[model samples]
Target: MTSVSSPLQRLADALRKDTVGGFLLISAAVLALVLANSPAAGAYNAVREFVIGPSAPLHLDLSIGTWAADGLLAVFFFIVGAELKQEFVHGELRNPRRAVLPIVAAIGGMVVPALLFVAFNLAHPDKIGGWGIPMATDIAFALAVLAIVGRGLPPALRTFLLTLAIVDDLGAITVIAVFYTDDLSFLYLIGAVVLLAVFGYLQQGRGLAGALDRSALPNWVVYVPLAVVIWAFMHESGVHATIAGVAMGMLMRSSTRDGEHESPLHHAEHMLRPWAMGLALPIFALFSAGVSFSGFGTMLTDTVSLGIIVGLILGKLIGILGSAWLTTKLTAAELNPSLAWSDITGMSLLAGIGFTVSLLISELAYPAGTVLEHAKGGVLLASFTASVLASGILLRRSAHYRKKGVPAETAGRE
Candidate 1:
């Protein structure tokens, strides 16, 4: 890894990142949305909803939800958690000073959305439980947008957004654990902690370098089984199942400025994305996105779910825009130069694309009835609106930046 090879390797890695993995993910997401809106939607729903395996036969019981949540999502979180740890340890976010912009933005983003959601619920106190529905960042779509633009923005902008989204997820995970527990089950929680600690020790030792190499493709294997154990413990221990994603991601691996492409840990993260996207996310989305249009007209007027709608759309704009403005105003550091205040504002609006988080919160808060149905509507509307608006703004801004001779994407300020 000489300095000479490093730059070439990075460029190669970036190209690899975009071509294979990126293409697969984008294809999956696009296919999902299209299929959802297509006449074949019924078939899509049936496939995702279908439960497989025997009833305690060999005790290998699993549902559509179980495979997605317990199986594939575990891998997604494991990768995210690994990235989170790496950033803190060695990436751009290694220093508090470097991290402040995105950190403050993330905090404000989380806080304002939650407050707005709570306000919506409070106005119709019956729905107050649905407060956490508007608190997530859809990283894939965001990254895909950056990739699509091709030029005009600096690389730093994408990096900043990526870091911010990861932090935002960390916060959302915390909210789920604190607000959404079904039971104390202290004993189960204890089991989770013990499992967590065992993984921690393994990670600290780099999970016995050689054993990992022989068993897995690379020598740094620790994240996968550890994530599985954590999921089992976390689920049985009274925590929402997905918290396992958050927890495992946090403790998965040490960061490597060395760029451990062959490291088993990194290898696992790479391998897992397809499973998470092609399998887990699509499965989850298929099951969750179906909203019966029965009495559909009246549901729109219903305040509880409608409030969810207003809160997400309105709240996302305010929090993301206002906080970003405040950060620029109060600090010497500025927005990515290729991006205007307008661009950031538009991106903020897109931050309202709160589909996954909203769905998870809805699951925790209201498991039944028209209110949940409404909340579903609210998420769809808000996310759809936010994504379109953000995309529009980004395209417009990219044009402006290009006129001034900036790359459309890739974060080059000069």
Candidate 2:
């Protein structure tokens, strides 16, 4: 059967074409490491440590690293929010039955790694907070790797990974909001909610329903200021600021109207995605990935580092594979005939490439000191290790398919 074009297919194609963003992210990370270890280390440290933003009335003064984590990353989260909404509305997740495998795999991927991290840090109560670090799967990095090495694999594999990673992100965002946050300001949170409602009302075409197209509301004129207000309120309310993006994005209506096939959500995502993937994420990686190598050698013996590494490498592999296996056995579900066990294994390892969100969680979980440095190092190391392992497996599978005279285009038929 010939493959029909769908939202998931389009997403897979878009991801495969985003080679530039993937390369930029990796290059920026490498540049950070090189600068951190070279003679320019002092300048790098000063720039990252320098405080910026308002100090008095706004109380917004924050280090460069904090701005990267809390501010720029929100753009990335906005795209993620839109992707999640789209998936639930029009993609694979729209049907619960079709979505079960990835949902089960995502849960397994998150839970097992967290438990493994906790197991390693059980003796050290101080390090318990870092358990969330290993639970995230950086979809950008994973998709980049998949796009490069999995050309011969079925398109279903890419969709599976994308769905799983998006769910994993939802879990990560929930953890940040509930467990990582400290103190509470219900008033500010309520204010944020009100602003969000106003934003939704405008974007959803409520009062101005037939008066004007939703896109007619200039983003700079109405949306940007409202988003900033919500973000500020979220920050002040002791909730993670990135959550504002998620809440606002979900509040947007995803339905088509007024002879327009695309919703405002799709329009916003289309406008913002290039910047989020190409610049915002790379800048965040540049600021956050500059861990000093002074303690690199000692990370091997460090309990927190060991836990993060093992949790990502071993726990993700076991959890995802085992969950998928169990799901197939317990129900009438079966693996796609076009794919082999090796394909799943490679995808599982790729799921362990938790670079972006993992680093962000590391900063939140551990104080800025030796323990934190070790955790960051572990994240970098584990992601690299996973990339290498996954590359080998996927490449081998590609060659196997080639020898059988299977064309790469055939994969899209799924």
Candidate 3:
């Protein structure tokens, strides 16, 4: 009696929940760590290192680990791109007044972490390239932690965190595109750009009005192949293939036409977010988080590892909270009435849970060796520490709000 769509719809609904997605990611990472450090370590390494792609004209052959990082993460970034576009066009970023706080906070979050990393690595020029590792806040993980611990907290607090994380993601993406690329190929880069333009042109005609104006094909038939081609060209261009996902996501039409309930951007996001959260991210975590703990104690003492720990935990705390305070003082912007400095403190600490992009940057900054392993270990340790500390703070805040018996919508209102 069950319809085929029912199960998928239920699965999609579950994946959309931040808590569910977060649990899946954490479980995958933990499983990976266990396998890497246990008797199955050899099997884990073999699976990750296995390569199986065509090596023809594009040199597409890559290990499983590389595919997870470069390919699967692209799906995750595409969701980020769609969310960013929606924010810029129809959400918080559309209003400069509403945007300044999170925007400034995100910049402070990035700059302070980089500076902290550089300071720690000043004597080790060879390890300084790893500075980017601590500059990212894994949105899924952070949101999950917040959702679990922040029950009854003001909605404004969640908004503040979401906006800040999105801005933070944009900064991370920019860093990857500009700094991490190597051996650039202009010809292939141009081809990727051209494909992006064509993709954008097609999105303009995806609305109801546009569909009535001309015969149109389903998105899977056209957009999917086009996206794959763009991703391929980007991969060959020596830039991270994930950049293609971000570009295509931004190019999608965000404005809805007459009689439409949602824009093309939202529709696509709705359809794809489940895949990103349910499959792409968890698989990426499974492969990426398998760092061996053979010398974790010594690794923690390494300059590169120390920098990441300090940057993620202390740097993000100081950067996000300090910039937000300064923004309130230096400009007409003010913290939302429903939020207290305590809420911001917890959110700022929560920002320290930098996992996904941090791991990617670790791989990019260091070749396979002890340094790479240490860098990843630092990320895992810092993220765990931050999550625990932030949970303590948010849990207390949530209890306070709950005891007050005040609705979240009017928590701090006079």
lDDT, each prediction: 0.64, 0.81, 0.86
TM-score for model 3? 0.89
After superposing candidate 1 on the true structure, give the runs of residues whose Cα lies further than 4 Å from its correct spot.
1-47, 52-62, 121-123, 139-152, 206-223, 246-265, 273-284, 293-296, 328-340, 401-403, 407-414
Worst 10 residues of 2 by lDDT: 405-414
Q: What overall lDDT, based on C-alpha atoms, would model 3 receive against the true structure?
A: 0.86
Any residue pairs clashing in model 3, and if so which? none
Ranking by TM-score: 3, 2, 1
lDDT of 1 at 13: 54
Runs off by more than 4 Å, candidate 3: 1-4, 176-180, 206-213, 259-261
Q: Return the lDDT, model 3, position 42.
A: 97
Best by TM-score: 3
TM-score, every prediction? 0.76, 0.83, 0.89
**Residue 74 CA error for candidate 3 (Å)?**
2.2
Model 1 — which ten-residue stretch has the worst lDDT? 15-24
